[model samples]
Target: MEGYAKLSSLISTDSEFAMYRKFGAQNTQSLLCYQAELISFGDDLQQLAASDRRSQDTDKRLHAENWYELSRVENGKDQQIKKFDKIRKDNCLIQQTAIAKLDRLAPYNLRNLRRWLTRSAFGSSFLYGLEARAWDEVYDHDLLAFPRSYAENDKDALPQLFLGPLLELFHNLIGRLYKKGTTKDTLSPEPLIRYYDSNILRVADILITIISSGLPIASITALNYINRTITRLVVVAVFTVTSSLFLTFLTSLRRTENFAVTAGFAAVQVVFVGTATGAGNGGLLRSDV
Candidate 1:
């Protein structure tokens, strides 16, 4: 219960856990390749920069200097300013682009689908699931269940722009009606009808404003909480029924365990209502009764 409360709080504060918890992602980029390629590029540039001809510089003379640019010149002098400048510009552009690619964050994700393709060729995937290094690959267990992702499209849009969950209900219904697949190798669940919290939160806020504006709400603090609970009361009912149906459909749990979980969920809501009532409305109860 405590963990779930924290999770709900986290979902509202930062979309970070929401992305990881309810979406599919991958780790495909290779950090090793990125580092190696960047190093190779830098080494080549350094070797050219340090090159000196005449052989007078001893071993410090790299690439023989003269041999560094052995390509035949088209129509310029042995080394003209125009040709050299153009060549330098071209090489710098290429190198800069390569550096930018290497600096990208995607390449460091070694757990993506690219690792599977690498299993046969480079054997780099042998260290998968080792958990030794940050760059090391790991099993796709956490991500396999989420093969698809929803980004900004998943949020509820105001004024009827986006309706993610409501539309998903139709997609699920159509897929089943069409009998889309021939095989039953996998499972396709029809998710419970879900409504995002934005609307409910807005409604709750409006009700609080109305109650507080009309009365001295500090004296009726418990009443305010009770009103808030009543706003979500329908949602609690839906969750209880849906949870029971899904539990029976998916799990082999004995009846006792199922009843306990189902009842507990409802009881938590009722307990809140009862607590708020107990705090307020002393006149509703009598010692004579």
Candidate 2:
């Protein structure tokens, strides 16, 4: 019995025995860490894929809504146009009133009025300090509110109210991953995955909003670039044609009997060449021609 107790104590307290157990624990912890990393990466990839799908669906929905709104607005075109005309008249009256009020306040002459209109905040401003109540009274009476409201809401509210939270959520997710990788603590990916799944729709909303907003700006920029390129090409073609005609005229005159005429033509050719090559009057000489 004493020998048995001694053997048990040796097995329990021996450094080698303790080391063996410690090695097993370490291996188990390492496995868990590896498992966590793999799971986190897989989950993140799956979430991203799911978010992309949701974004596509959201994009479709927004497109459908835009078409629907556009159609609705189009259907009421005559009434909306008439309402716009009325608003324009009202705005003119308001501007006249503002000008009169300013004149009364300052006793300005015609020249001063012209200067003030050019320099004053009222002339440069949209609505010109018009109150919301006044705007509503002038513009909103008997008009279908849906079209204007829809456009304004989509332009102003969707990006900030709808996408802002999703951006913050994505940032939080990235920070969580970074923290997990850098920290020494044993962390499970399950909770993070759950959180991502819950917020995937919000992420999709953000992506859709960004895509929609960016597309219009991108299209406009491309259109402007194309327009500028076309204008430059037209200008160059015109300049080339004109120069060719002038050179042909000069060539015809070279065979003429009049030496003075030939000499004058040569002088004009020199001036033309100099102007075309940007030697005189900067680049404006080409435009002058």
Candidate 3:
């Protein structure tokens, strides 16, 4: 009776159990009845252990099935690519559902679920192929599930889903830089840099914004401010260096020109640089200079 009362009190008071009640009332009742039976069989220690194992196995299967249902992709044309793209677009919804399902499980069950996901082929591919926005969603969800402070104390408490996706996105960005041209055998930095600056960097900025927003203002010490300032300076320095190199390349291309053509090429370079600088500065600044 004492054991049953304690179990009842825990089920009533624990938030995790509360979620279980909300989503799986039948399972909750079955768990309670199973516990009652274990308590009644006070001398049968073997039976108690066997029953507990069975209960744990059932919970693991239930949680695994729930997650699989939410994440599984349907078969269709270009199925693999389409499935992954759909998963990325629906990442927010999947995160919500997965978290809710996770909340209903015990810590051991949670570990089992994570193990199941990590071992599954579809799960591995889905995580490794996540794009920028999808990776952001997963990162955010991981942070929420296991904050830095909590993760410091318990390393394996939460799933490490963010790392694979982040690495995959980085790898994809690098691969995009070396795309082969059909006509010319020459490698072009212009298209590569443009794509990098516009897509990958833009996504990186968004991730930074998300991280920054979560940081406490009180934690913004002088060192933190200085670091941010130094980062901005570094970015400016890189921009200046790249711009100078591009100008040098343009000038070198005009080395074979006659005097008039060289003058015209220099003038054109000046106009092009002015236009580019204006556009780079948000196109609102005057181009008079």
Give the higher-lDDT candidate: 1 or 2: 1
The digit string of per-residue lDDT tens for model 1 on 1-289 reads 2223433443343222232211112221344455565566666555544453434644334434444343333453333324345445544335434444331122212232244224442223333343323232343223222122333222213212223333345446763565443311112121212334456445544543564243322223333444555654665576567667645653455789889987876686556656666755564566535
State residue 270's C-alpha deviation in candidate 2, in Å.
43
Please identify model 3 stretches exceeding 4 Å from their true place. Answer: 1-30, 42-162, 176-289
* Candidate No. with top lDDT: 1
Sorting all predicted structures by TM-score, with the top scorer first, yields 1, 2, 3
TM-score of each: 0.22, 0.16, 0.16
Candidate 1 wrongly placed segments (more than 4 Å):
1-29, 52-197, 204-289
Show how many residue pairs clash in every candidate, following the order shown.
2, 0, 0
Kindly indicate the candidate among 2 and 3 with the higher lDDT.
2
Worst 10 residues of 2 by lDDT: 14-23
lDDT of 1 at 242: 67
Model 2: lDDT equals 0.36
Best by TM-score: 1
Error of 3 at 179 (Å): 11
Scanning candidate 1 in windows of ten residues, the lowest lDDT window is 183-192
